[model samples]
Target: MKKVLTACLLFVSSLTFAQQTVQRSAKLPNSDITETFSVLRSDKKIKQGEYTATAGNNTTLAQGTYLNGERAGIWSFYNISGKLIQTYNYTDNQLTFADSTDTKGLQYVMAGVKTDDDVTVPVKIGGSYSFRPTFLSKVLTQAINKDFGPVANATFIHTFSLNSKGEVTNHQVKVCINGQNKLYQVDDSELDHDLTRFAPAMVNNNPIPCKVITTNTVAMSNGNLPDYANSTYLGQ
Candidate 1:
């Protein structure tokens, strides 16, 4: 009985050791191993064809696809340091090809343009609720007014061009009074004289030229004639 018990114990120990060794030597399947790339500030994990990157603080820095080990597809970046970015698609271990001067890039360029360039005007297109021009215009107007102040009652016409990428360029102003049906060229000072403000129109999520009109009405608490306020301009 003692010999049999000793043999049984030895067999159990050997089986345990063999199982442990097998487990240690086994290689995890590639499917079980997720591909990941990490930086000091951010870390990205890739699984199958999906990729997601997060900053140190748990902020989503980028999300896209990984082909093999290379970045592929469209990637969006926010801020210079790549604090926020997104990647899409996977092709040849790199992001898919995007036109260098796409609409989004052109919008950034147009926003920085010092000189004017003649381009096409962007027409309003129907889309989802968020893409409606009227909604955007109202939102922009309200934002401008909240930032600035109420503007005077006058018709100010601004002509601007948009490049093929839907970027605004070549901004000019034309003003018209109630009495004058014809449009008149106005200088920047005159245009700026009134509390007028402009937010560039957007086309396909890009800035473009769109006409904006601002009007303000001034009222006095005490009854006063309109002409009395303009004493200096009475003779002129």
Candidate 2:
């Protein structure tokens, strides 16, 4: 019986490790051209490594790394000309801090709308809150409790707008635990308090209004990582 149990355990372990890494490509939404991009994944979750994105012209649009499904280290972004436009740091997928000394670091992720010849578009700026891996790891490993646990996969979406100065305002947030809605219609002031750390977006050497959206997902079960890959542009 002991040998049989050991064999069963090995079979499960093999299945877990057999979970293959994946790569997916798609076109960005609302783009004028067929601008395509791709991302690498492991165990269905985005892996920690270097990635390059290309535009419709096959020009490099961005290059960066993902650490445990979050952008970590430094990411370099480029324009249509392939010129380096922005380089930024991410901690736990949060652009919480920037070093002034490093001029290469981006102050904000640009959010803009295209305008037609007759119509004008508005400029907005924003950012969101994310969980640190250390904190999240605890939550994942801990037993579920009524007061302080999800014990299963969950996702939270926070949206907001920013002024030219990079301050968060006019926001809405929703939290879902294991596919169940827990909180929605949170106050803007309450959400703004946590967004004070985000850097502002800039355009043509001037700060501009930007819209920010952040999605946080926690994968609690095996092979559950792929579902979180819907949006490759996190914290942007």
Against the true structure, what is every candidate's RMSD? 21.7, 18.5
Give the distance in Å from residue 160's predicted Cα in candidate 1 to where it truly belongs. Answer: 1.8
True-vs-predicted CA distance for residue 98, candidate 2, Å: 11
Q: lDDT of candidate 2?
A: 0.43
- Point out the worst 10-residue segment of candidate 1 by lDDT: 126-135
Candidate number with greatest lDDT: 2
**Clashes (N, CA, C under 3 Å) per candidate:** 11, 6
Residue-by-residue lDDT tens digits, candidate 2, 134-219: 11222222322343354445565655567766566555545566555653443333222322434555455555777556565555
Compare the candidates by TM-score and give the number of the best one.
Answer: 2
> Distance (Å) between predicted and true CA of 10, model 2?
27
lDDT of 1 by residue, 128-185 (tens): 1101111113233333335334333333344434344333334443333334433333
Over 4 Å off in model 2, which ranges? Answer: 1-20, 32-47, 92-160, 163-198, 201-236
TM-score of 2: 0.34
